[model samples]
Target: MANEVTTAPQDTRKPAFWYGLPVGYMSLDLLPPAERLMEIINQLRGLPEQERDEADRALRLYAGIISLLNTNRVQECALGVHPDDAGGFTTSVFTVSTLPTSGSAKLVVAGLAGSAADGPDEGMRPLELPCGVGFLAEKRSPAPRSSRHPERSDAASSHIWQGTVAVAAPSTPELIVLQMVTPDLDSADDYRNILLGIARTLTFTDPARAMAADEDREPEAPTGASAAMRNDFG
Candidate 1:
């Protein structure tokens, strides 16, 4: 069995594999999720005072809701915010989970496809990931209860975009699932592409094996040494 961890190139302490999330995504997996979120929010600079205040309250609510929903199976989660180009922010929630048990990749895809087909507008299709085979499921639906505005009765009419990717572990029966949710339906295509790009970076491998492979790679010889070695060999 391999341990799952998302890491950056500069941080070797967290090993195994890392998701290449683009800029503007703030990780919330650190201890005390709310504090981590606040720290990230406070680090942001140059926003108007009122806008910054509103973002603070919104993120606090978002973090609170997320903390309640996250389960033990969730390996990683992050919140991404980007300019909507309409003076407001487009927010996204991204999570990666290890499913309980599934026989194989094919079975998992079949199961997902069956369920996805039942939804009126949901669609599922096969996807070839860099690490393994998987499927992509997408659907559009009314915003969740938490997403609705408290003061607006018509807020429920708003729609959200949900994209999910399920990839099988290379050497295990486990399925690594990545899901992204955003209420910015206008940018659905862009979000779908972002989700697919992140899915391709998912890999399942033992830390020890990955480190050993790096060590086994051939080192480049110095320029002069390479010529001398070539002449000597000739």
Candidate 2:
């Protein structure tokens, strides 16, 4: 079982993003890119044969989640554009599990301009937000049925909703991408609303200025309130 907790950054000035997992859902601390790769490698070493396969599958899923939130690079880019050249992009990921179901979800916010101003072409619908042109689309797929129980026909589907909130700027346009996957379609709207709430909190900050401020400051502990929340997972 995974350890779970409700965690958030201490800085209120920073935007608050949400995954709408049960309030106390477990939070996994992602290692910085370089360290995470090595950690995964170490975990795979010398596992019992029976446990190796399960470990591999879980690690792969965790790795894909880590890649989606790549933040160590000089620029934060989302949906294939850099925030400076485009605007800026920020991403957050969360792990969610309900009884027999478990999975991860991600939110990517990007600054857009020029040709990129137009959001996704298919299944797009308008969204009303104070800062951007917003639209949302939901995608679904049948969950893999159990092969052993081929005769059991009741199977749930997974859902992902890609929502975009494009802010119209004469020079720099921006959009927010909320991609969420859940075990069933019934909760898709709930997750959509959660992402929308987070997007509404979005505000543009000058990355250059933020970097300069960091340069002048002394190194500090990580963002979360507790050390456990700051501990990186293998």
Candidate 3:
């Protein structure tokens, strides 16, 4: 059981890549980017003056990075902040992009692996996600190699951690690739678990129809206002 890959109950619906946000993660609006940026800036109004200034600068820089990704076919980006016991914070980034051509899931995995197999990192393995069978891999920062002396490589004291997952979009020729990066390797297992949860939320169903289904399942509220009038007095 320990060696098996745990997954969520299958959701047999959708023709689009609609996924749910994981806890502590905020999704950025990609439909014209600026709309979401303004929303985030407004939320910083409650912070201390100095902290707010610092956060503003950082947010602008991050927003620029997202803009560059949008030019490519990246559909979504999310940021997660987790508080630690040591009174500090750890952060992670997640992005989803659709591949250019249509192909089977096996072909998609092969293409992803062929491109990164040369990188120095842990090996890739089969991952059983709710969407379907997929592949997962962890990548580490490469040590800087000398340009003049290609034979000699500089040893790096530390490196960053990144995780990638590739799953095919159901009923479509598209393939979706998910990538996550974090500075803290100590919590790699926990981060991986979060990635698994996010992957399970993926579906190829139409967002409009899926949302309508959810509304249909919701319980109806009390009809009359007279039965529910409790405002500091019975």
Order the numbered candidates by TM-score, best leading.
1, 3, 2
Question: Over the full model, what C-alpha lDDT does candidate 1 score relative to the true structure?
Answer: 0.65
RMSD of each: 10.5, 14.8, 12.2
Candidate 2 Cα lDDT to native: 0.39
User: Per-residue lDDT tens digits of candidate 1, residues 114-224?
Assistant: 665565644787677656568898889877564355657364447889999987665456677889999888888988887886775565444345546656777654222
Error of 1 at 105 (Å): 5.0
Query: lDDT of all the models against the reference?
Result: 0.65, 0.39, 0.63
Scored by TM-score, the top model is: 1
lDDT tens digits by residue: candidate 3, 115-223? 5555554557667765577778877775345576665543432556788888865655656778888867787787886776667555554444644655687655411
Displacement of the residue 156 alpha carbon in candidate 2, Å: 3.0
Write model 2 residue lDDT over 1-234, tens digit each, in one string. Answer: 112222222222233222222232234454446677687678777788778888988887777765655332111211211123235432223321111112211112222232244765444455554344544555565655757665563643332334333333222221234444445344456556544544443333333354466668797652222221223210
The candidate scoring highest on lDDT is 1
Clashes of 3: 6
